[model samples]
Target: MTDKAKKKREPIFSPEDRSNLRWLWLGYLKKRAPWLGAVLLMILIQGLVYQQFLSMTESGLRVIFESGEVGQLVLVCLGVFFLFAVRGLMSYLVPLVTVRLSNEAIFEMRRDLIGHLMSLDLAYFERTKSGEIIHRLVTQTQQLGVFFGLATAGAVRDAVTVVIVSGYLIWKNPILFTTAIVVLPFIIWVMNFVSDRVKQAQGQAERALADYMNGIEETVNGMRTVKIASQEQVEAGRLMKGTGAIRDLMKRVQTTQALVMPSIDLSSAFVYVLVIGGGGYMVLSPDFDVDGAGIITFLLGMVMVFDPARLLAQYFGALQSNLVLLDRVRSLYDEQPSINDAPDAVEDFDTGGDIVLDDVTFSYSEDQPLFEGLDMTFRGGQVSAIVGATGSGKTTILSLLSRLYDVKGGQITIGGQPIETLKVGSLRGAFSVVAQDIVIFNNSIWENIRYVNPEATEEDVWRAAEDAEIADLIRRRGDAPVGPKGAQLSGGQKQRIAIARAFLRDAPILLLDEATSALDQATEERIKAALGRLTKGKTTIVVAHRLSSVADADRIFVLEAGQLVEQGRHDELLETAGLYSQLYQAQKKGYDGR
Candidate 1:
């Protein structure tokens, strides 16, 4: 596949790139630009209200020093009341708009992440830790919400305040205004400097957090095993150590980052005092000769302006932390998928289910080999079985047939076309898999079965279930709730349900990895009989653990440590006295021992 095609199938975020989050946030803001304009209008109204307050205060001062009119004083007081009311209302509305915009952005981000994750190749899931994926989906997504809701709004609001307030400051005294605004550059420099340190520490904190979360997930899922082992204290200590690491990382970041606020605060406050003191001297000294009314108005205006400036300093510190989080999220969004289909790839509409491997070599990692110099073929309308010991790359064979991972050295073909040249959707559509580890969702039997064929009617689902010998079980659970992960069902029941799902799919190719291993011998024999009727006229590959399972297959392939050692009919292989014959002898001995 071409690089562009590969990128299209990749997840939106990756661990290495951290800039996508910034782009996503910018995109979200652009989407809500209209609401932002409305917020700006409200801000303008707020500024006008503050100007009115300055005027009212000045008028009252005049009433005290010059007019001495009680009527004028009452009028100014009335204006103050109305101005405060307008300011309050505008403040309330600005936040409402900000929150609405932020929430919409978060919703879009979450949906995009999920959609991208779904499109990624299955190999990514196999390599990446499930706990980490869950952490990003649930915990990191929540943090993203905080970024949108608090940091995004605060940054914009503080920026607006800085602009409006600085304009008012310039109007008061150009000299003081220039000096006051000078501190902003210093603040920016400090923020940028502090952010790098914060980024490093925050990244460490997130890693530590992931470790702690991983422990929690493992512990929760395997609580029974941990308790049975009587290693609860050791586990608790390990968990505590992880949590402690996270706490320490957070403290380091928070401490160093916290310095930013006080530094900016001291600088802003010094500037504020210098401006106020200079203004006060000018107002008092007759040599300066500034008008009392103008001075009073300017001082009141400065008061109105500086409040936001102080808040800006506070929120500037908050922006640093948000930047760190944004960087982390963006890194994930930027990852490239390792495997993807070609743009001009053929989409398989009629799969005869013929599969071939041509001098293929593969490895999950460069340093570790799973397969080397391997070649095999499975013809259509035949049942082929692969038998091997654990870690002998048995399952890897099935994965390659489906193109779950790209072959490192050679090619895999399905229906005479290179699988990489076929669109992923089309390739997957041709095959149905029943893996050793059965996965059942928290849903009714009918719903789970129909998951493989969403358009299938109840009748179709029941028919498939009957073929899988699971129709009677579903009837038993007609009203029974299947708990999460199918916890309510036994292992055998879950396996049957998975088989039913595959049967309902009715794909031209079927791959089974110990599909009946969870069932008792009697149930396995029963299901095998049913499968005989179901798998007719289709290509089938079964990874067998028991010799009995593959005795009836058209062909049996023996693998030991990724090498294909034998391939033939069961009886023919036994007569050859190769790896297959040794396996058969061992199984026969075990059966006779029983």
Candidate 2:
């Protein structure tokens, strides 16, 4: 190996990765040390028993072939048979314990990974692709699980067997022992060569697979749009391209792995030839001081060492390939949630009074600030609305109020308390949000409704459903699958389901974000009625692009390019003939034209 390659083998992790390894060792491996130790002990016993069995064979062969006798043949046969049984048991237990230990650790790691992902702020997920996250969550861990099996089975058991057999070879005949292992250096070099390519190829293959999965998720979720636009062929071509990329990358990975066996075989064949030729020459020469049985035993020991040594080589190569997966997983684990409770954050803080954005400055991107020194408020115990053009920062205002994303500057106060000072859960628990993009899980309506409030009784769910005018949906669908994102339901139906969830939440504050924007006039009328009841006697804040929806709002705040350009009751703003009036008039003209 080159010096660079040798150096590359020393550090599995960079300096940044050292912190993450502490978690793997301290959290997972250390916890499994007892079981791990027991497995190693079992492997050790099995290796010693195997060596003893080989010695017994040498004795039996000497009596039959050279001495022309059959002393203790029956005893010898029974003893060898008993050793085989013990060896068989060890084989079963070794893999069983090793796999179980790995499986449990992986199960816990998965649980922790999920919990950590949930704790991250919305911005992290917004910037990240769902496909990449899923790949790391599911696929990376699975690869590690398989690698652990090889690390234990090949590294430990095979290693112990090789050591014991090699020692016996050295004691019985040093010349034969040295000749038997002449191929070791070549095998090591071959594995190192394959390993360098394996890491690079596997990394690319993993990325390609993630992209392919992401494409599947996107196209499958947007299937309706594909069909509506008559772009099925285009989507097919896109996916075909993705699959082709994955296929080529995998071919590289598989091709590299495939070379391992043949390379080892060639070196092994050389060892077999040298050992056989050398053993025969020794048997004929009295100067060597060895019997026919000794020569036979040396040849058999050579046979025994090759398989384990071959496995060890393959294990190292596979370990290199899987290191990327391990790094990907560690990268995720190392991510700290950008939004978390402060050191002195208060959880028991009360919620009431106006929610004021005190000169708040924020942005989704650094170059273009969405809300700069912007200020607004929704009165306590009253329904309010914010209206604007598409890029007017309407939805962003709602996100800030709910603390889904923190403001870059200034402070937001609820009930006269700075929101950042309160625990995130306590702050968010004060409001129930129904967003433009509603999420419906792939489960029955009953579970979907009840999940938000696990303690809420069945009757409570049905009542909330009735209040949202969706009781009939639950009654009819009852336990039937909703499919992903509620594909089985229409837009109006999904809107109603979100409203039902809000009603069940019954938080002190209500946030209605374009709830009725996507519905038809008839459905809008129904949803408006539901919203009317939901907002009663609560601190409600509504954001919408449709001026008609917010026309009757108790107070209207009009935004223009992330600035508060207008605010008042609807008729009051219209009479002023400002930006709000222009928006309302334009919308009115469009509706009239339609």
Candidate 3:
């Protein structure tokens, strides 16, 4: 995020994000608590045993150096081996269980986030970038895994280890223990400084990474246009710039995290000097309780306590560094789609009815309203065409008819009932859309057609294909892959598949937005013929640019800047010499093959 974006963006718990952050994070963590508990317990037991092993070393040193008890030394050394074995096994089990817990959290977190993303309305997608969404869903959600395995769980268990070992050291020699822990406050201060820097750097790095991903996506999606324009070098440079930015930010994160270990080691070194210098002086003064053997034990115990303290410091740093992930993931999960089903919205509705836009008003921007007091009706069981120049709200009408963007004012209805009152599913289910810009999934022909209606039979698919004039192509291709966005097929062939989907859907209303545009005359006529059979007896709305295509419509509605300027059959519209006549005459030369 830019510095301005970071500033404008308050904390993750903004009013728009209603859920409590702690509760949201704990909700996923609670489900995997058993695995968490199992790992923590294993580490706790191992860590305690490690303390015993250090005590055994102290006893063995006393036996050899002071008392000279050879038999006692043998027994003490054997005890150390078994204790170390338990410690090693525990070290192995901790990671194994932690991984399982992390993955379990990752799976559930991703599942819930994806379902939420899908439930968002079209406007959310329009406003949010695809790469940013992918970052939230894929990259940020994975933070749950690391949050448990390496950060929170490790810090908690290691803190426990530090406490147990520190108590043992203080019990043995309070003077030396006090001297050994004098640097602890400094360690803590260093940790806090490092954690804040790491968190800031990592957050910036992740934002940069999202932009890098979006750059690659744009370059790939528009490769054909890039090649045509000879902008390959430009796109490559842009992508490299994104990658370079991400690299620099990530390096900043690593540099901050690197401060943790070295600061810990330096603090440990200070404690070591204090313990060694103070213990030797106390022994010489004849005021200490024990001899050199006891002093050796004090050093060994300090080793036990300080090492875990070091580990705790590292885990604490990691925990702080990734705290921002909770905000990132929660930001997405809290986005509530405004356009969900109303409390009284009805479904199981009748399919056959006139689509009426009554006193409708809408706009993509408030200052530039597209439609106001717009009123039109397409009678059931008839074909209606909408024609307008570019920017004259041709596609906007189709979007309004389908309720893709709800009108700012007034009501759109089917069978005299407002569409907002009907369930969104039932309302959208009434219309089948085939726009000039069609979407073809990367799948086989059989799968592609069935995707529109999964319950469609193979026989039903074949019949629909034949109706849309795509049967011959499917029979030849034999369900070969369409590659990305149907790159394997021609424009006309892809349009035919979309037509097949509509045919298979066989809804009561049809929406064709420039469906017959950007095609050779031969291909246009063939698709027009298929469209002719497809629209029979249905309330079909067609938005066309070429006047020649809608000349045979039962009604042609001419719109200018979101207002209906004229409405009549083709001969009647041409005779009116209004916007319809002007647009028709502009394209008359090509219409007449001149």
**In model 2, what are the clashing residue pairs, if there are any?**
none
What TM-score against the true fold does each predicted structure earn? 0.89, 0.95, 0.93
lDDT of each: 0.77, 0.85, 0.81
lDDT of 1 by residue, 1-594 (tens): 988557533222344334555486476667777887888788777767766676678779889889899999999999899988988998788788777777778778778778878778786777676777777777776776776666556556655655665576576568656665667777767776666566667778877787788889888767779899998998999999998898899888888877776876777677768767776777788877555775667766665565665566556555555555666555566666766779888885447756888999999888989888898888878999999788888888888878777889888887678888888878888889998887778888778888888999878888899988888888877856688778788888888888988888988899988988889988888888778876888899999888788899998888888899889999999899988888779988998999
Best by lDDT: 2
- Residue-level lDDT of model 2, residues 1-594, one tens digit each, is 887657655343445446655767787889888988889898998888779888998988876877666656767788899998998998888888888888888998899899999998898898888999999999889878767764756588888999998898899999987887777778767777788788788889888888899999999999999999999999999999999998998898889888888988888888888877898888888788887888888878877888887788778777776777877887886677878889999987556588899999999989999888888888988889998888999899888887889899999998889988999898888989888898899998878777678899888998899888889888898899899998998888888888889999999899999887668898788767778889988998998888899888889999889999889999999999999899889989999999
Q: Candidate 2 — which residues are off by over 4 angstroms?
A: 1-22
Best by TM-score: 2
What's the CA error at residue 414 for candidate 3, in Å? 0.5
Backbone-clash count (model 1): 10
**Backbone clashes under 3 angstroms, per model:** 10, 0, 0
The TM-score-based order of candidates, best leading, equals 2, 3, 1
Q: In model 3, which regions exceed 4 Å deviation?
A: 1-21, 67-71, 591-594
- Measured over all alpha carbons after superposition, the RMSD of each candidate to the real structure, in angstroms, is 6.3, 2.4, 3.5
Name the runs in model 1 displaced over 4 angstroms: 1-22, 174-193, 264-280, 290-303, 479-481
lDDT of 3 by residue, 308-347 (tens): 7878777766665456676687778568887767889999
